[model samples]
Target: MEIKGLRKIEPYVAGSQPTGKNIIKLNTNENAYGPSLAVHQTLASFDAHQLRKYSTLDQAVLRQALSEQLGVPANQVIIGNGSDDILSMAFLAFFNSAEEVLFPDLTYGFYKVWADLYHIPFREVPLSSSFEIDSQDYLVENGGIVLTNPNAPTGIYKPLDQIEEIVKA
Candidate 1:
């Protein structure tokens, strides 16, 4: 039964997980091989007591480290649990205008989910036959544009010059 004043949403469907030995799980971006020895060592030495407390919301240490490595100010860095979290925040923050956002049709599926969830209009520009993003397609009027470098699933990377052209448009 449908409830009054309730928001209905079409959930994002992820790729299937096939179970078997020797199966490499590319659908979920899982590494074929297990974590490196350094990761294992770090986990082995982790303090279980820390789990009882929540981590800092600002993530100052991580942000500072990332900023130092990237040569940017700590205030300019925004960290999230993952790219999905960051992208979701970005969609909500920047795609508030009535104009439609644009992204590649064959890009990450989460873009559509976030757009729908936030009630942001969007359009999917088709990729070229070679699975390359034609920068010209995104040159048209748009509220915003999202491009995944070394695009997901296809693993095709658009050149920096082409990306700059889209940004300039």
Candidate 2:
């Protein structure tokens, strides 16, 4: 049951559980609201039998609907289980075995953990004086890079222009 030289694994820690039924669920950082009425209606209208099939893979029709709602082209959209999934996909698509990934020292620790799990090299770039992401700090090419917006706990959002500059670079 034991694999030799594999004991360096760290445990995953989720936010604390709630103690009361009616207690406010502020722990997970989920928006303090429920799904839209239309979304609820859509769920109620969902056909459970769809699950019996392949479920249309990524469900292009729903993706198109999201594109219309967000005013973005379908080609520009990417589907993922969550941001973590998106991060993993980016690492896979943008990085190679010989390349490295760059991420913040104070952001989601999961990024580094993923890098290690995948055996991808990575560098931890430092945060700014005000805990901001300075894109200019990244100097490597042909490597994956990650940025967690509105970085958790601190919840401070960086400017869109900064992200634009990073993408442009």
- Please provide, for model 2 over 1-169, each residue's C-alpha lDDT reduced to its tens digit, 9 standing for 90 to 100: 6788774545556657877767666646555577899999999999888878665667688789889999999777888888789877877777786766788888777777677777788888888898877777864573767777787545778788877777777
lDDT of each: 0.90, 0.75
lDDT, candidate 2, at 140? 51
Largest lDDT belongs to which candidate? 1
True-structure RMSD for candidate 1: 1.5
- Give the C-alpha lDDT of model 1: 0.90
For each candidate in turn, the TM-score is 0.92, 0.73
After best superposition, candidate 1 residue 160: deviation in angstroms? 0.3
Give, for candidate 2, the lowest lDDT window spanning 10 residues.
Answer: 6-15
What is the per-residue lDDT of model 1 for residues 38-133, given as tens digits with 9 covering 90 to 100? Answer: 999999999989999999999999999999999999999999989899998899889988889999999899999999888899999888999888
Estimate the TM-score for candidate 2: 0.73
